[model samples]
Target: MMAQGKAIAVRRERVDESVSGQRIDNYLLRICKGVPKSHVYRILRSGEVRVNGGRVGPTYRLAEGDEVRIPPVRLAEPVASGPTPAGKPLPVIYEDDALIVVDKPSGKAVHGGSGVSYGVIEQLRSQRPEARMLELAHRIDRETSGLLIIAKRRPALTALHDMMREGRVQKRYLTLVAGRWPNPLQHIKEPLFKYLTPEGERRVRVSSDGKASHSIVRLVRRWARFSLLEVELMTGRTHQIRVHLAHVGFPLCGDDKYGDFALNKALEAEGLKRMFLHAAQLGFVHPLSGERIALQSELPDELRVFLDHLDRTEPQKHG
Candidate 1:
């Protein structure tokens, strides 16, 4: 139900030929984009939405000539209990000119979704009030951290987006495998397919025939129990690294998605928090300047602490 505070008058935006065949609720949600579907439904269920002054069910489809009326609601109002900007994001690296790459910590999502108030991009907005533009060049899973790119201006955004589409953006990651890897250097040439569950969760897995995926992983260090590997992806699938690595029997440390829950729980009890993967390196053409650039993020605190624990548990192996 829409909030009981007070109904505010809302005029629906018009849609023409392009969106001629969308459902009413879908159209309303698009017009009220960013407003939660629940909120939209709240207004709808409370008799706040009407077509030509007549209450309409959510499933009521729309046609060319329909007058939609939305009851009082200010869509732009910030959600209640919004967090202060600073507490929301942490930046590990910053640069002047066209971009800023942050070494994000685990647990903080790359972009805010679900119940989160803000993500990395939202926090970075506060750092540059003068600039009218800022956006993420690429994304890393919320539980994963490393070099995350942010385009500071429209030109940079356009250039970077083009490069990403052309596959010129090179991303390298470092991950701690759950067990000693089978090969010193491995390349998995597989195809990937993304499956979305009914609950809205997305999972990517390997298939015999799907989107062509390939990545070369080389052993960086070996311990009595685990191995650190440098992984380079030639094709970027949703959960490519996590899924591929796990498919080959060496899931990333603390990767609850494709990794072992028992191991994650054991590590959590030992204060080994979050997933253990990092966007160790990222290289791309400068969106505006056309200069070649590569950025790296030093391992974060949580990763450092966990590695230190491994060093202590099996010093000889680290030696």
Candidate 2:
């Protein structure tokens, strides 16, 4: 076992084929077990870390044969049983040789990072240790639940990424906003710019200098104070639906970020603990088979129950 606080030598490692194409920070995180993320980033920014004898940003992808300078990092004390397996098995919606589609529950992240210890991918790996490759095809917010896809092969992962980038993938979400939806179908073509808050939390806002974003929101139902809407993304952007709706005066229910905080607090007291957003449907061509595939998931029980509560308390003002 490696001793704690021992004077360690700066070592250089050659990137291997197994870790190729992964971000440098991620690669370091995997090998530098127990090192704090801030410390890792600190070394990178201070030029202690190098790729081919030059400083590279955290997002740099590692290629085979690239030499990386690794600084000595003190590992955290290990537990009795090398860190307990993270997360649990989730409900699988569909599975094949190339992919695995699961009904992800709300409050669970797709992958672990940024203070999250484990997520869907980690849990799935723990459950299927024999599987050679497993990676997320896309990501949804941790507060959002529903159909999520995981690629089982590298080629499938690459193809899925291409499909999403070319706008060939159709992602549909269900959300309950704070006001009555005005239109049956509305095309929201607002550009979104990502920004960080004073506390370093990620956020997005509509700005002319931002990336082009498009969302089609169709009214599904309406109550006196809330409206259920189906949101389709024509262009994928971070927090696209949440930002777009909030900008147009319809913040999502239970959304802590870019939402009415007062209303959210009241919602929590009323039994809604999570954001009212879910990835309800996805349509795309199978990357390997060239077959059109469409999948849908029903509203989670928590969301359905909340909607029922609204129906019982607030009379419908619009359809």
Model number with the top lDDT: 2
Among these predicted structures, which one has the highest TM-score? 2
lDDT of 1 by residue, 1-319 (tens): 4553433567874544334444678767866755678988887888888876788778886655677887666555445875557654466565667787888887777767777767887777666557555678778888887788887654566567777767788888989888877677889987998888888888888987579888899988888888989898787788999999898888887887899889989988877778888889888767667677778888888788878888888543544
Local distance difference test, each candidate: 0.77, 0.89
TM-score, candidate number 1: 0.73
Which residue pairs clash within candidate 1?
A: 8-72, 146-279
User: What number of clashing residue pairs does each candidate have, in the order they appear?
Assistant: 2, 0
Across residues 1-319, which tens digit of lDDT does each residue of candidate 2 receive?
Answer: 7546444578899976545677899878877877889988999888899999999999999887999999887775665667557555788888889899999999988898889978899888888889866889999999999999999876678789989999999999999999889999999999999999999999899999899999999999999899999999999899999999999999999998889999999988887889999999999988889888899999999999999998889898854
C-alpha TM-scores of all predictions: 0.73, 0.80
RMSD of each: 7.6, 4.7
